[model samples]
Target chain A: MLNLLFSLLFLLSLFCAVLTGKETETGRALLDGAGAALRFCLDITGSLCLWSALSELLAQTGLSGRLSSALRPLLRRLFPRSAREDGICEALSENLSANLLGLGNAATPAGVRAAKGMAALGEGGREELALLVVLNTASLQILPGTIAAVRASAGAASPFDIMPAVWLSSAVSVGAGLTAAFLLKKLWRCYR
Target chain B: MALLSLTPLLLLGFSCLYALALGVDAYGALLTGAKKGLTLALELLPALVILFAAVWCLRASGLSELLCRLAEPLFRFFGVPEETGLLMLIRPLSGSGALAAAGELMETYGPDSLIGRTASVMIGSSETTFYVISVYYSAAGVRRTGWAIPAALCADLACFLSAAWISRLLWA
Candidate 1:
């Protein structure tokens, strides 16, 4: 019922916006927005395509496998259970690589794949998957390359200007999100 | 004329190099991903357009002015400028809008200027509230969003306070 109300309000606002302006003004704004959106879309698509291709090549060359092996120690610490499991380490490496490069579009699928690999070790249930979701959400981003790229494309004086703040905020947010997720999971378990 | 002539060549070279390095077969991957991106963009477009239009109309209709008047005292309590309240309201809906406003403030004042620093700090440190709410809650199938809204607003307030303090400490 509340969802219906929100949807109604949203639709009404959209309708009113469309009806408010003269045809010319509305057309112009739409065109401008479309152009900006297209540019943004293209940038992210290009990043994803390039990263996907690179990841494929890395897999074929066995470099990704080696990289996974190398990072296993650290990966074990991060995801203790999943580290010993097959394919988990490789997926984690791929996800981490994409994330570090700031290719979120590319990273998402790899993260999902990693989670699936992790979940194979556990029974299929909501309780088991909750931790996976939290970890994915808490995926540590050293740099928000996508947002930085967007800001650069938007003509910011210094694209790297937000780097410090991004690093700080992401660190805090990831820490807080993980802590909350853990506490909630524990509390839920206790009640159950 | 020279720069203009070189621009296309530079772009073409970059594209060719990128394609070669990535072993792009048909450019179809690019096209497919771009199509997805366009769809995502279009999905968000109506909401964004409606949001901006509503805000603009509200200001034109004097509702924002009245709200601004009402918010003056509250703004003072936070050591934020009266205009900052308008910005706070807008920031949740549109990141670009907030950034533009912040840019204007930075330019009018100096980059290291108090107001400029504050605005930049605010812009950098905060998330678009409505966007976060819509994405996270909708994905989780959360309908109430009552507690969520308050929690988010409280976080925003904390961010604002932290931003102010950090800006003063770092830049001032």
Candidate 2:
């Protein structure tokens, strides 16, 4: 998928360059793009490191665990079938807590653990597993750290000013995702 | 609104205090986490450079602008600006790609602009649907993904559309 996208963009640019007689500029654009990306990454370094360090500290201190455990009730409601499985409940909590903390690095391992355990239930676990994935995909983090970092680096006067908007959109998206999931499951069951 | 900016600082302070109270070598943990972050940055560099370059090339050739123009009406119907068409299109496929496009959009329109805020909100609210679906399903060995992709895409669309109006309502 990524390969196709890359090739499509480049191919069109090349074709446009040919028609516009700006081949030389097109070549420079690629170099400029690389340079910009390097600088952008550099700008992101501080916040990324800071957030990761903080999340790490939280994880080590068990604060993240507490957060995850706090999610237990909600997870129970969302993944009732899988929640009854051995160790799956704990994994789901950790996954969600890590995700909420914006700890993407930590979230993946725990999420995979939950997914593996859920998948072990065979055909009966499909709906619950799907729910888990949707929850992860549309999971709402308290802080929009990465996006704020990007905005700050881009010279925004107030990078976090979009918090309310982010919160609103995230809630709407999660709601939409959950609704679709439930509706689709029902439809599939009826058809089956 | 004003307090929202303090979230990161608060989280940091709380983490540090909690770690200290727990008798966990807070300094050592910070260093370890920083190392992890450094590693993450290193891993992110190549993808960032490649995606940024590709997006830049597309933008530079004016192809993106033309495409945005073509998609403008559809986007307008959804309350999003035409400039964000590329961002929305690439968002579900790749995080780094979306970041690159968001950076470009903010740079071109200024980060305080409605379009920029909308991009930021959209990026914050949504996830890489296709990537998440693939990773989670493949890891669990689930062959038939069923309705996951459609559901996630619906969420992405909701995020994008609401981001535009929400940004405008809140900031513009």
Candidate 3:
């Protein structure tokens, strides 16, 4: 059913493109965009593979375990269900570890893992996952090294120049997103 | 040469600290979680590919421009300029498209320029609308997204306004 909907939307978009009278240019742009997306996917997949390997190695070497243990207290507060403790800790640690290294690509898998873990424990699927998505999207970090790397790769003069703004904006976005999620959740619960 | 040589040593040190803090008991758990992570990566890849292709097709077809035209007045109500309406629409569809548009604005108008600053703030703060909405709604099996769009758009507006105001206060 969802697949059908997605296909219909895609066809509609294509129709709109043709109707816009730049079918040729739009087709070219679409090709370029697809190429870019493919590249992005490849890059992200590679990063995730590396992150997974490192995470496994860290586990073999006992680092991941330690990180999870250390993060337990915080995780407990965030997810008070004792049954969900291990999953929450593991997910949070994986996310924070990747995030700290400024690997947006790698962090996504960890975030998904966290969401799945949360879902497994029956912690409100979509609503809870939406909060996580928002949190990840509005992720607060001291270093936006990934963006800087992209800037440098693109031949920017000073990749670090955007750091201050990145910090400020990320902070506000994360705060706002968390607040909204919390308020919305509370409101939903009350209304129900 | 020296910095490159030091990188491994630093990584090793961090790894050592990590192992010590996390300990041996949690190793099994970590492995389990990592496997789950891999599965998720596999699952999301195809959908992302399809969505990217579709968005690209839309852009190439010039549907984005028409959509932008339709959305212009709506964006203006939130204090975003008419020129940037295309960006708000594109940003949700494609990160690169949004960034490219923002980069062009920055290059033409200067990084600290009002439009550039606004774009920068918008980039970091706003959600990738349709993607997020669809994912969340589907995950919850929601048939009616009655208030969701309006609520999210309102949030987007707040984000835009706050970003503009804050950037102006600090940079301008």
| Model 1: per-residue Cα lDDT over B57-111, one tens digit each | 4433344456568887977676666555545655666655565445334433544
Pairs of colliding residues, candidate 2: none
What would the per-residue lDDT of candidate 2 be over residues A83-162, giving only the tens digit for each residue?
Answer: 88759999989988887777777888999999999898987687888988887788587677778877887888778878
Error of 1 at A106 (Å): 1.7
Candidate 1: give its CA RMSD in angstroms: 8.8
Between candidates 1 and 3, name the one with more favorable lDDT.
3
Per-residue error at B91 for model 3, in Å?
2.0
DockQ leader? 2
Which segments of candidate 1 are over 4 A away from where they belong? Answer: A1-71, A123-128, B1-44, B65-172
Model 3 ranges with Cα > 4 A deviation? A1-73, A123-127, A146-157, B1-82, B125-157
| CAPRI docking class of candidate 3 | incorrect
Best by TM-score: 2
Give the per-residue lDDT digits (tens) of candidate 2, residues B1-172: 6677777787778877877777899999888888887787677788778877777777777787778888888878877888887788889988877877887778778889988998999899888878888899999998999888888888888888888988878777
| Interface root mean square deviation per prediction | 9.1, 1.7, 7.8
What lDDT does each candidate get? 0.50, 0.83, 0.55
For model 2, the superposed segments whose C-alpha errors exceed 4 Å read none
Residue A59 accuracy (lDDT) in model 2 = 78
Q: Can you give the TM-score per candidate against the true fold?
A: 0.54, 0.94, 0.55
Clashes of 2: 0
B104-166: candidate 3 lDDT, tens digit per residue = 445435555666666666665554655655654554455445334544554555566666666
